[model samples]
Target: MLFSSLLFIFQFLPVFFIIYYLSPIRFRNLILFLASVFFYAWGEPRFVILILISILINYIAGIFIERYDRNEKIRVTILVLSIIYNIGTLMFFKYFNFIIENINYIFKGDISFIDIPLPLGISFYTFQIMSYTIDVYRRDTKAERSYINLGAYLCMFPQLIAGPIVVYTQVSKELRKRSYYLKDIEKGLRIFILGLGSKVLIANNVGGLWDDMAQIGYANISMPLAWLGLLSFSLQIYFDFNGYSLMAIGLGKMLGFDFPQNFNFPYISKSVTEYWRRWHITLSTWFKEYLYIPLGGNRKGKLRTYINLFIVWSVTGLWHGASWNFIFWGIYFFVLLSLEKLFLKKWLEKNVILSRIYTILAILLGWMIFAITELENIKIYFGRLFSFSISEDWIYYLRNYGMILVIGILFSTPFLKKWYDKQANKILCNILLLVIFLLSIAYLVDAAYNPFLYFRF
Candidate 1:
């Protein structure tokens, strides 16, 4: 269920949190483990068995890796097998159909595609579980002994389906021992309200324009309209994902756990490199720690470093979806990042206004590539973005969505945050939070169909 939905906010969360708070501290993790499984099953009943089995496999794998620590060959072998199982599971469920279409195109064979659903949160929980076993193998952290503790850590509902991707090490302590605090709940609820506003009030409103453009047809849009639509999408995606991340974090805090920050006002960035550093902070960190650093990172020669970046970006794109467009999106960023690394960074830093403009344009174009899945449609959309065609249609759209768009852009920066920070402890601030919460609830009552953009991944 969507975190933004009235049903989740009104029914599921209230009941879950009440039961959670009443449970004994010793029983909390077990309660969470069971609740999370039920939460997943509420939406994806068919995948419950799949996730349970995957969790069991990883739980066993971690123990084995830790057990054979003194024997290099055995531990290494076990680690490799675990990696294969996790990656293989991801491949079969997420990419098997993607791979099939390509093979058919190449060999002209009429191979039937598998009719299987990608298990809910498989991408997220899989990575989290791998981090556990890999850390055990590297002796960075101990393998969790309690099956309930391990399961709860991996299945924590707050960030399970959509995540800032809380690494095992980040929450290992909390999984074993944590205390409830009223202050924490208060702060976390306010943060949750803020995220609720962002998603329901901002992202949902701005996303309508992009949906309109899609319904109208890409080729028919004027150049100005095209850019405006993409701008709406750029804002939509950032708020949609960012809003969810904030909710996840807020929930974590409420549960007496502190998840890492996942965003840093990426839109304000003046360079693509800076943007990547800010956007999806956790994912970037994950790749850097697990993938890039292992491939020697920048410690390698210049060519090797570039090659490592290429591999990371390619995989990063594929991680988002089982589509060629996603791969292109990754490559697009790779080229921009490579150019910035080569020479653009220095030049861009010299002029703030021009640099931000350049970065914004680059990001909007990238969003265009990301939003459209079909290559031919992507090509048409790109053509429209630069077509220089003129129309009054864009004026109407801007009139309709201009305020939310403005709020989205302003909110994308630290402006609201700065103001909020200044008045955080004041009574007015408390009232404002209440108003935001109430208004967000009201919005959901009328419009409860919000869909998470990253749900596909």
Candidate 2:
């Protein structure tokens, strides 16, 4: 049930929108919850039951935590249990095989790996539910007495799979009360169309170049070709994930729920610390609130603060996948961020362009790790990136992909929005928007490459 799929566009979404608009205002939450469940179940019917059980467990835990507020120990016990349950389910479904394989490799024991199927969106939805329970226990939000509203909060389909990690507090009020104005619908349509164009017109095309180059593998890569592949991948991931987030936010707008923004031109950041602030803003904030703050945050001494930062980021990386690569990526980031904190801050403060270049290079190198399956291949890729094994075919690929690479880099920054905003007159804007909309549809109909990256997760 990809948001960009033909069935979703023609069938599921249309039917859901019709029913939702026709339903009474009081029953809207119930309708939304049912639709969300249907959305999940349509993809993975067996796992829908598991998710429902999780929802019920967390929902009940939240109630108990609120009810036993006078007994701090009891409240803490319930909260801990709820978190453990959520994380335990996530670990079992997502990481069991990963853990088993690692253990088997480490020791000479032959442990058969369990073939556990990961439920679609379990990582995302589990975090959402845990945030709900924790917020209730921490007094940041009240426990929703209405189960229907709570269900709606948990299962909102827009951000359910590849999320902006919408917190329970952000849309709790919207769950109970929302209005669908014509203005909101219009704005949402514009945002959605822009996101669609980004995917179909730019990201998918650039991703094809990435895939084609990567198939050649790192062994044959010339320096220019290697750099081209890395650059294309960096752009592909940005457009893919950010495009998805835009669609999610736009869909939330159409539904009259104001989901927060996820990205903010992160590639423009002059430091790794700044980049994290701008990129995946929601997830970063969630980690800060739920994980970092609880671990004494920066209140601890400098050394402990660094340790806390590393641990939190390592967990963040592991959360992305149950792989050593992700863990290394986390540590990679931790080292850069720590260096900025400890020594480089003052030096970078005096040299803006140098700082920006350093930050971009670090991020690009980090993404090389994220893109590779194994560390050895990543090392080989880096070696090729620095070597001068230029070939005619590799140069041909680079020249062919050069224009798209430029467009992707431009798109990564804020220039497109600036240009779009500079245009005046409603009629002119609407015409341009219509052109983009038509092009998006045309691309969807004709494009050969349309990979949804987060679908793997």
Candidate 3:
């Protein structure tokens, strides 16, 4: 059930919004709660029970943690148990196959391979539930007395499928009391249309270029062609995931709930540390508040701070998937960040152009690892990126250079909205926006298949 799909845009979303708004304010939560359950179950019916069980377990755990607040030992025990339970469920569902496959390969163990069905949105909802329990344990938020309110918060369809990882603290007050204003709804609609346009008109088209370049065998890839593919993929992923985030935020606004901004023009960043601060702001904040802070953070000496930073990022990578490539991707960023903190900062400040070029190259290389799955293929791709493969022809370079330039320039700034807004005449802005909106719909209708990258994680 992709948000970009026609079924979602024309059918599910329209129907849900109409019914939800028409319902009594008192029954709004129930309407959304039931709709969310149906949304998840529609795609993976078998996982519905898993979702219920996990919700029930955490809800109970949260209550116990709140109940035994005076007893420090009891509170700690319950908190530890709840954390283990949530993580254990995640491990069994998400990583059991990943673990068994590795064991079989390393020791030639006679482990029978069994297909495990991954529940739709399990990673997202699980984290939501975990955050709730942890917050209750820390006394940051009270355990919700009403099961319905808590349930709705966990499985709210928009962020549930692919999230900005909304936590209990962010939405708890809104869940209890919220209002809908016409102005807010209008603003939300505009944001939604803009996000839809980004996904359909720009991201999907760039994704086609990425797919075309990928289909060209790696052996035929030149350094220029390699750079083109990397740049295309980098932009494709940003637009796809960030487009979805914008839509999610718009939906939250429409419902009179404010969701945090997930991206802050990350490509414009001069440093990896700054980039993380801007990109996926919610997730980085989560890791910092929960994992890094608990591990002593920067309150300790410089060496320990670096160690904690590395551990947090490594876990962040592993959280994305149970793959060695993701681990490398995490470490790859860690290395650059460490270097920037250690020596590159002063050097880059003195040489601005070289610094910018170096940062772009490092980021482009990181995206290559992220885009590919296998280690050997990544190695071969990296070799070509450095012109180690001499077989590529001039046609390859000429054909892709223009597309690469477009992607690079687009990713490098936030020009579209600025340019449109610069037209001081309101009528002109509205006319252009209307045209873009219609074109986006046409592009979406014409494309048979469009996929978002972050949905897998």
Query: What are the per-model numbers of colliding residue pairs?
Result: 0, 0, 0
TM-score-based ranking: 1, 2, 3
Q: Which candidate leads in lDDT?
A: 1
Q: Which ranking of candidates, highest lDDT first? A: 1, 2, 3
How well is each residue in 1-457 modelled by candidate 3, as lDDT tens digits?
Answer: 8777778888999899999999988888888889989988888889888877877888888899889889989988888888898889888888898899899989999798778877777777778888899899888999988778888898888788778889999999999999899989877776777677667766787676567656777656777667777877877788888888888888888988898899988887776777888888888888888889999998999999899989987888778887888888888888888888899878887876787677778888888887788898898888888875545563554474566447546744877658755763477766766886888778777978688778778
Error of 2 at 284 (Å): 0.6
Q: Locate the minimum summed-lDDT window of 10 residues in model 2.
A: 419-428
Whole-model alpha-carbon lDDT for candidate 1:
0.91
| lDDT of each residue in 1-457, candidate 1, tens digit only | 8888877898989999999998888989998999999889999999888888878888898899888778999998888988999999999999999999999999998999989788887888888888888888888889989999988988889999989888899998888888688999988998898889898889999999999999999999999999989989999999999999999999999999999999999999999999999999989999999999999999979999999999999999999999999999999999999999999999999999999999999999899889999999999999998888998889999999999999998999998899999998899999999998898888888884588888889
In candidate 3, which residue pairs clash? none
lDDT of 2 at 418: 85
Candidate 2 lDDT score relative to the true structure: 0.85
lDDT of 1 at 358: 98
